[model samples]
Target chain A: AQSVTQPDIHITVSEGASLELRCNYSYGATPYLFWYVQSPGQGLQLLLKYFSGDTLVQGIKGFEAEFKRSQSSFNLRKPSVHWSDAAEYFCAVAANSGYALNFGKGTSLLVTP
Target chain B: DVKVTQSSRYLVKRTREKVFLECVQDMDHENMFWYRQDPGLGLRLIYFSYDVKMKEKGDIPEGYSVSREKKERFSLILESASTNQTSMYLCASRRQGTTNEKLFFGSGTQLSVL
Candidate 1:
């Protein structure tokens, strides 16, 4: 079974500061990776996805993630974060053939002024 | 934009009551999923339907059943509601035949079983 691990349970950053959320996966082969964000009382929204091609993928809301095969990691990063960026972030992994996604426990991002 | 609409934004039910949560998709997607979200637990899949009349069990299926009589609608049922079942329920849909497609989600229904 493919699984995703997000080490940080909570992260806080000041407005305009750079942000990075760590994600690691355990899969036998190269897996499909995704980053999702959820605001309070809202459903999950896709931040970005990585299937094939370049390791780095850009997503909506000025967010990006890099798939590092050697580290079994697909970490989400942003050059600068705004207050709206404060939300719960999840990392998910799926097998090449499976349709279901395995999600992490999530990391709560807090932005301060 | 794809929209997956869940019938209710909030629901309250008593123990042993029958509960049904309805989900409908507007994009004519072939795949629909039901998941439950709790604090510190992320989202756990409860059930998924790949096609009309075709359903699959996800990570957690206990005390839950689903119906997919029509392609655009999928319903989740709780035969006997329990306090443990209280959580935020989310419905999502995505097109089949693609490995990289992202899921479109509903705003979610927060269910409280007392």
Candidate 2:
């Protein structure tokens, strides 16, 4: 079965500091990887996605993710963290022909000023 | 812009009552999905519709059913609402084609079964 794993349950980062959220996936073949962020009481918004080429994909809100095939990972990174960046982040994977996405447990990021 | 709209932002109901959650999309997407969001569990798929009148069970679909009578409308129904059914229900839509496309989500409906 395909699965996504977000190791960190909660992470605290100071504002203006760099941040990295780790994600690992288990799939049979090359998968469609995605990172989604959700604010309090709001639906999820797509952060970035990795499908075919370009291991490094930049998404909205100045976020980027690197898809590492060998490690089966797609980690999200930000050079500078803002106070508004505090939210729940989820890593998801879908098979090439699959319709539904398999999401991880999610990581809650808390930004301190 | 693609807009997926959920009927309600918040709802409260009594246990054993029948519940209905409606979703509509303006993008004319062929795929619509329902998911329940919880604190630690993340987002769990409840049901998805590929086309009109075509519904498929997702990861967690036991207490829910779906109806897609039109291309832009997808309705999620709970036969008998229970306290455990209280959750944040999200509606999403995506165009048909490859799996690489991102899904457009609604603001979500927070349902409380008391």
DockQ of each: 0.69, 0.70
For A64-85, candidate 1 gives per-residue lDDT tens digits of 9999999999999999999999
| Residue B30 lDDT in candidate 1 | 89
Kindly list the per-residue Cα lDDT of model 2 for residues A1-113, writing each as its tens digit: 68899999999999999999999999978899999999876678889999899899999999999999899999999999999999999999988754778889899999999
User: What does candidate 2 score on TM?
Assistant: 0.96
lDDT of 2 by residue, B14-106 (tens): 999999999999998898899998889999999998889999998999989999999999999999999999999999888887579888999
Give the top-scoring candidate (TM-score).
Answer: 1
Instruction: Supply candidate 1's per-residue lDDT for A36.
Output: 96
Model 1 chain B lDDT-worst window of ten: B94-103
Give the poorly placed runs of model 1, Cα more than 4 Å off: none
Highest-scoring model, lDDT: 1
Off by over 4 Å in 2: none
Model 2 chain B weakest lDDT span, ten residues long: B94-103
Report the lDDT of model 1 for residue B99.
53
